[model samples]
Target: MNELTPDVFDALIGQDFVVTNDDGAKITMSLTAVSRFETGAPATDIDGNPLRAVGFQLTLRGPAQPLLATQAYPVDIPGIGVHHLLMSAFEAGRTAVNYDIVFA
Candidate 1:
């Protein structure tokens, strides 16, 4: 399957997705921010070598239900297709939480 690029994923903002938690609870998450604040610096390796790295930052906001998870999981978006990614929480509130989805 062709995976989505950061630009394509960013265009999918305001979309909703579903994921099953470890406890078997299905939750709904809305795509809030396609990416977090980025400086646009060229990605490089530890040795400062330029690398052709492409990544998407998906911010999922869901209800106060059990957290979606901070690990690799599969999420399905209506027309985008299913993607297995590592979703990590960066900031959260009483109602919703921000997740940084690793689109590798």
Candidate 2:
């Protein structure tokens, strides 16, 4: 798999991604937005070298029920392959739930 960068997902907005739950159920989520921002302080790599100061957040919309706990989930992105991503439920309404995947 390639790096999970904003560029990798920029073209994916409005597309659908399938997230596999812990119970092995597949939840369909739409890629709603890809928000980018400055990290303020420079981030470091494992070797302690300075990395990019920019970061991004992925917003997805899915069903409201079966509220998913904040954790890593296997998500299948069209043409990007499956990847394990940490996601948290950001909001929930009567019919939909929003999840966020932050890369910082």
Candidate 3:
């Protein structure tokens, strides 16, 4: 699998990703937004070299029904391989629920 970066997902906004529920059912979620930021602190590599602290967040919208519990789920991103991403439901409306995946 390729490294997941903000740029990698930036172009994928508005695309649908399939999440396999615990019951073996597929739930479709649309990639609503991608937020990117930089941490104030500098990061260091394994070799102790300084690196920039960058991170990103992905917001996905799915149906309100079958509200998924906060946990890691297998999400299939088209063109990209399937990845187990930690998702948390942050908002809900009458018809849709929003999930967030943060990478830092």
In angstroms, the error of model 1 at 11 is 2.6
Provide C-alpha RMSD values for all models, in order: 4.2, 1.9, 2.1
Clashing pairs in 1: none
Q: lDDT for each of the candidates?
A: 0.71, 0.90, 0.91
Clashes of 1: 0
Give a tens-digit lDDT track for model 3, residues 2-41: 3788888998999999999999999999999999888665
* Tens digits of lDDT, candidate 1, 30-98: 888765344455787689975445545678887765766578777887677677778887887898877
Taking all chains together, each candidate's TM-score versus the true structure is: 0.71, 0.88, 0.88
lDDT of 2 by residue, 1-104 (tens): 32778998998999999999999999999999999999886577788977768889999999997789999999998897899999999899999999999887
Candidate 3: worst-modelled 10 consecutive residues by lDDT: 36-45
The CA lDDT at 59 in model 3 is 100
Which residue pairs clash in candidate 3?
Answer: none
Worst 10 residues of 1 by lDDT: 33-42
Candidate 1 has what TM-score? 0.71
Model 3: lDDT to the true structure: 0.91
